[model samples]
Target: SGSRAVTIDTTPPGAPVITSVMDNMGTVTGDIANGGRTDDTTPTLNGTAEANSIVRVYNGTTLLGSVQASGTGAWSYTPTA
Candidate 1:
């Protein structure tokens, strides 16, 4: 055996993109540039993320919902009013 040094690098997950947000009317909206807002209290949110990563949806400090990205890095979540 010989003396050796090993270094471990740690990196956090990347931020998930809220690419699409659905309104209560079931209409689909575009990306965050769309502001992720709607008149309806309950709406579905869809986005892309690192595969298998957790995507947490929030409004200010309150958490709306959470979802896991699929192998293809696609995810969707809907919150209750």
Candidate 2:
């Protein structure tokens, strides 16, 4: 009989931080901060996560989209709807 060893990764990635949310599709194109508003339907989201990891964006439990983080742990996404 032969025995085999298996390895598993249990470490979790760092928490993602949303740096900015920009509205580039509307007349007021800029970062929406401090409880600001925008007419743009598809605002761009910029953030950082674990390097080379998958970042998922959600809105009230509904997933908008997913984007892979860069080698530097940076990621961005813009939803179509």
Candidate 3:
């Protein structure tokens, strides 16, 4: 199957307030990469984007998974690798 281009309004959906992001080392920053290599293979990723929007977690170009933001703009994605 081929892919079709779906256009989405690139306008601001309001400033998404990412409150917290916790890992095995406790809370970390949001909207930025803030970790080095760790022994933990599975880590819980949490954040807040535009509510009801989809949040995709990625390592470089590799997409880990996607999580739907809650009604309160809260989202979490736990990686298997």
Candidate 4:
């Protein structure tokens, strides 16, 4: 006789919210407005997601990068290019 235990999660995490986008490479570094423009090549993105979840950042259809959310559900990502 053999026994095994397994666990499954069906509930999905809440949608991520982009709190702010900062131009780290710009001469005048600051947060970029919702529809604003920037000359920064590698901007920093701040957001929130489910704790310990994988947060993926994308540009239109292209995947930029992925980061793990902190225990408080906070995450940040900066594109390399």
| lDDT tens per residue, model 2, 1-81 | 999999999987778999899998857888999578889998998999999989998889998889999999999999996
Candidate 4 at 81: error in angstroms? 1.8
The model with the greater TM-score, 1 or 3, is: 1
Q: What are the per-residue Cα lDDT tens digits for candidate 4 across 1-81?
A: 899898899888788889999997757879999998899988899999998889988889898889999999999998897
Task: Flag regions of model 1 displaced more than 4 Å.
Answer: 1-9, 24-33
Best-performing candidate as measured by TM-score: 4
Candidate numbers, best TM-score first, in rank order? 4, 2, 1, 3
Q: What is the TM-score (0 to 1) of candidate 4?
A: 0.82
Task: For candidate 3, write residues 1-81 as lDDT tens digits.
Answer: 999999999897764444444446435522334644444456676777887988877789999888899998888777885
lDDT of each: 0.77, 0.90, 0.68, 0.90
Model 4 spans with C-alpha error above 4 angstroms: 1-9
State each candidate's clash count. Answer: 0, 0, 0, 0
Candidate 3 residue spans exceeding 4 A from truth: 1-10, 14-33
Clashes of 1: 0
lDDT of 1 by residue, 1-81 (tens): 899999876886688987777665535443433644566566677889999888888889998778899998999998887
How big is the positional error of residue 52 in model 4, measured in Å on the Cα after superposition? 0.6
How close is every model to the real structure, measured as TM-score? 0.69, 0.81, 0.60, 0.82
